[model samples]
Target: MANNTTASAASASTALKARIYKAPEKAEISGRSIFLAGSIEMGAAEDWQTVMTNRIAHLPITILNPRRPDWNNSWKQSASDPQFREQVEWELDQQERCDVIAMYFDPNTKAPISLLELGLFAQTGRMVVCCPDGFYRKGNVELVCERAKVPLVQNLDQLIDKVIEKLTEEKA
Candidate 1:
């Protein structure tokens, strides 16, 4: 027989209103949480995090978004830069704390950091990656995901589905 517990968990998740926490502020993840780990090179990438937020807003979860609204493009990206260091540390900390890392590789942007994140978290089995066709390192992403047994999707829609799947599975 199918598990009644799984059905009840999925039903409960649907009633959840999502709470989002942007960077620099430490989030209190009381329950399920996901870190939006993706391409955020200001101009190079689109605000895909918003899309993820809108889609998953119904799920009872905390979204750890690193796209700071007050981001200053002129800040020096160096170890000596306090703001830069704070942002980096916040992202790292949130990713480590979250249950899931929803990562994306935008095709138009060369997301070197996203690739680095894939290497960092692929083996953790807490990642659901979306590397669409034309993304510069799709092949590399596929190989790592395949080996790590991570769920990899072809596009944003599928990525959302996979993330929801992971969240529901986590509930069980």
Candidate 2:
């Protein structure tokens, strides 16, 4: 029993230290990075990105999460704004360079940016999408996934599992 408890504790500690690429100022490392693109709208208290990071922390990779915990939607949408430009540019570059892009559309929000990202990388053959039935444009996302052959999941758990599968396949 003590052995098992010690093993679990070690695992949890390692997971807690998992690298999360949230700011562009961080050093760019060479390794598989999973760019997490998803819904972030008003009143969204669920931090799916953190859940995902913990789930896959054992893997030797970085998780690029674009959702800021303190995001302000009212910020100007132009690139001229320093903060806006940094966030946008970092996400775009991370998406392009990442080994896999995992996108999820929370049923409660429209997730317009996620939709655009799905369109942008649907054909990359390196994307895992989760657009639950309740999303406003589930049909469109489904069609795109079908035509592009992107693996789609039904929920957050499935998304994490699929991502793990992809990472394992890449390693093998």
Candidate 3:
């Protein structure tokens, strides 16, 4: 029993020393960013944001436009001042800094800004993932995705899983 205890203690000490001396591994998703392109006016945006946020919370990546203040009250101020422009620049910077982008398309109404972002990402040859709702798939979403060369996913759970998988593959 005494010999066994001494061996365990030695093993623990070795592990502690290794941990102290070893350099930390780089994060799997470090420096990665994602732009969430979706309809801000529709209720779908809030629902999708909640789902995406819960799914990607563990990742070492950032998601842009996950939440915004009440548009009805803030739109006037956002348009009049430079605040909206600053936010756009910030999102664009994050996009440039990221390795992959995940976008959501809701078919009830077209989000012109989202489509523009998709085009930009495509032009830059960045990895783009599209999450389109059932309604969106029946609309012009396919054309947009085709133009952007982005793979369309059906739901948020799948989107998160795919992102994690891609990050793992990139690391490997």
Candidate 4:
């Protein structure tokens, strides 16, 4: 009886919680997950990750957000840079593992990395992109999305709507 009680208590203590894991920080990922992959061009982009996380906090899922609060712009982009390499690797791993990838492109910023990610994952059928008007690469994004048959929207609100739809659709 004591052994049973102890095991139950331990399991409850370590039970998974709905949370957000920012860049370079990961965990033994469990349950439904969505990777927040989008425009984060050295703060040129808006803080969409926070908004997304807050909007979806009630869901039973983990949000893998790649916006690093302590990101140092001095770091080299090459794999030789430890921090940069780790952040890239973590984002890639989470994107691959996550059930869905929710991406956004802001018009005010030219997000090269976000463009690359969109290209890389467009055919995966796990991505939903929101590239609003005035974005530098809106045409390219739209054409690719059309060719790949990926879901594309015009704004953040639509992105949230689609994300919830996808997540709930999967659960059903």
Best by lDDT: 1
lDDT of each: 0.83, 0.76, 0.51, 0.81
When superposed on Cα atoms, how far off is each prediction in RMSD? 7.3, 5.8, 12.4, 7.6
For 57-159, candidate 1 gives per-residue lDDT tens digits of 6777788889887999889989799999999889889888899999998999888878888899888879999988999878999999999999988899999
Better of 2 and 4 by TM-score: 4
Arranged by lDDT, best first = 1, 4, 2, 3
Model 4 agreement with the true structure over 37-59: per-residue lDDT tens digits: 98888657888877776666556
- Clashes (backbone N, CA, C under 3 Å), per candidate, total 0, 0, 0, 0
**TM match of model 2 to true structure:** 0.85
lDDT of candidate 3 at residue 50, scale 0 to 100: 48
Q: Candidate 3 lDDT, tens digit per residue, 37-146?
A: 56554554445654654455445554454334433335443545565655565556656666666666655655677767776776555554554555543346666667
Q: Against the hidden reference, what TM-scores do the models get?
A: 0.87, 0.85, 0.63, 0.87
Model 2, span 1-172: residue lDDT tens: 0011211333545653335666454535446768888886758625677678768766766677776645577778998888888888888888888888999889988888888889898888889999888888999999999999999899999999999888768454
Q: For model 1, which pairs clash?
A: none
Q: Decide which is better by lDDT, 1 or 2.
A: 1
Pick out the ten consecutive residues of candidate 3 with the lowest summed lDDT.
17-26
- Point to the candidate with the largest TM-score: 1
Q: Candidate 2: give its CA RMSD in angstroms.
A: 5.8
